[model samples]
Target: MEIIARRIATEFPKTNQAVGVNIVSLVNALAGQVRIGLLIFLGVVTIVLLIACTNVANLMLARYAARQKEMALRTALGAGRLRLMQQLLAESTLVALAGGAIGLLLASWGTQVLVALLAKNFQIPRIENTHADGWVLGFTLALSLATGIIFGVVPALAAASPDLNQSLREASRTAIAGPGGWRLRNTLVVAETALALVLLAGAGLLLKGLLVMRTTAPGFGTENVLTVDFSLPRRLATLPGTPSMNTAIVMTDRVRFFDALLDRARSVPGVRSAALVADLPLGGGQDSLGFQILGRQPPPPR
Candidate 1:
């Protein structure tokens, strides 16, 4: 009928407008959530990197102390300070490069597991979009180089100093008792401890926040609720005005199928009411839009 067709045209446009608004809202929400998740991930990675740097620094310091005799002999044979420094720097650079290569492989595998865990625990939709792309690789490479320089420079300078004779003698007597060496080592240890404390505190705060949110007021009871997901095949997703002759038949069949399903579910023992919903409480994939009350007086400004 002409009337039915006209009514459908109007209703279909409104329905499509609503769906578009919902999709845009969903996308924006998902983007925000993913951004926050990435930030948290970067923070964790940075903390791990700092710990690795501290460990590498400690290892290099120990090696520097043990190689004091070699350094002393080189200096005694008239090796220039600049040459010694270059050699130490080169050695440190080589070690750093090797570590960086190993770290890249580790990070590649770790990133996959990290993404999988995030998807599973947080219900992040379209998680396959997350990957260790070129940017991630570049960032990891830069981080590796920076870490190497930070942890290597101090030990290299100490090892390549012109006054190696006193350091060698002290190394032979007792390395730990050296005046500035103990101070430097203690300072590194304190820094590592502080970083660890900060990371732990952040984790504790996140857990406490989750606990508070979970315990806060949830309006509805969910004791006997059941949920289901409905999806349409791509081939069946023709828009209402499309030139698909079978669209009406397909839509009618789909509606009837859902009606039958609900009827069967309701007929089952212990079933109360059966209703369909676009989203469920605590479901992660849903989003909401903001609205302002109209014709209401504004509150006093603070």
Candidate 2:
């Protein structure tokens, strides 16, 4: 960034505004003022992933415990520790991969809806349809594999312990979880619960904000009120005497045209209370200003 800034300064020495490059993600451009909400989504996703990993690990532990007898029998039959570990890890990885496949389908549908919402809210014109491309698929696969390895490592190692006497004794009856296993399970459960609560709170806050935005009045009645858009051509904005577009007479001609339009609208059958509006509530509007503040100087755009 420093090098770029220095180069920019050297190249555009005479520029009045700051000469620099703006570095930002596509999300910033699409989200605009609500860009921070992307961070909220990120936080929620991270927590959700953490919860999933914890749940997977806990379930794997229970599954491995239930299979202690079979594992002991295999050990007694001269099964190698590495082979047992590999087997357990493979099963966990497959489960994770299956879940990832389902998640990918959901993500594809979600991406479409997400893009539509962004386009509508941001008023982006002619946006391309969203789809899960090869990159997204690859990322999901990598994430699933990594998650499986991370979540399955401890349980796989515990189940692969060489000592079979304890497992064999416990296999005769119900298996009891060791202290370390209990601690890991309990800690994961607690952390998952905490993160879930945080996500819930954030969701509630966002929901409340949306409700507030929806309920707020837009300073206009929409019921039975229709807006018609039509452009006033140069001829329409020119008076009968004017030959060309004159700034001084344009306003007069425009007002005359609007009055004629309103009259025509009111003359239509069943039409009442005709009005013209330059801007509508909760819709796009444009305003141009040429002025300077009395005591404050506005900062230049960078």
Flag clash pairs in model 1.
none
The residue-by-residue lDDT of candidate 1 on 31-115, one tens digit each, is 7777787799789878977877887777777787777777777888888778877787777777777887787788788868988
TM-scores for the candidates = 0.73, 0.65
Alpha-carbon RMSD, each predicted model: 8.3, 8.0
Top candidate when judged by lDDT against the true structure:
2
What is the C-alpha local distance difference test score of each model?
0.73, 0.79
TM-score of 1: 0.73
lDDT of 1 at 115: 84
Per-candidate total of colliding backbone pairs: 0, 0
Q: Which run of 10 residues does model 1 get worst, by summed lDDT? A: 14-23
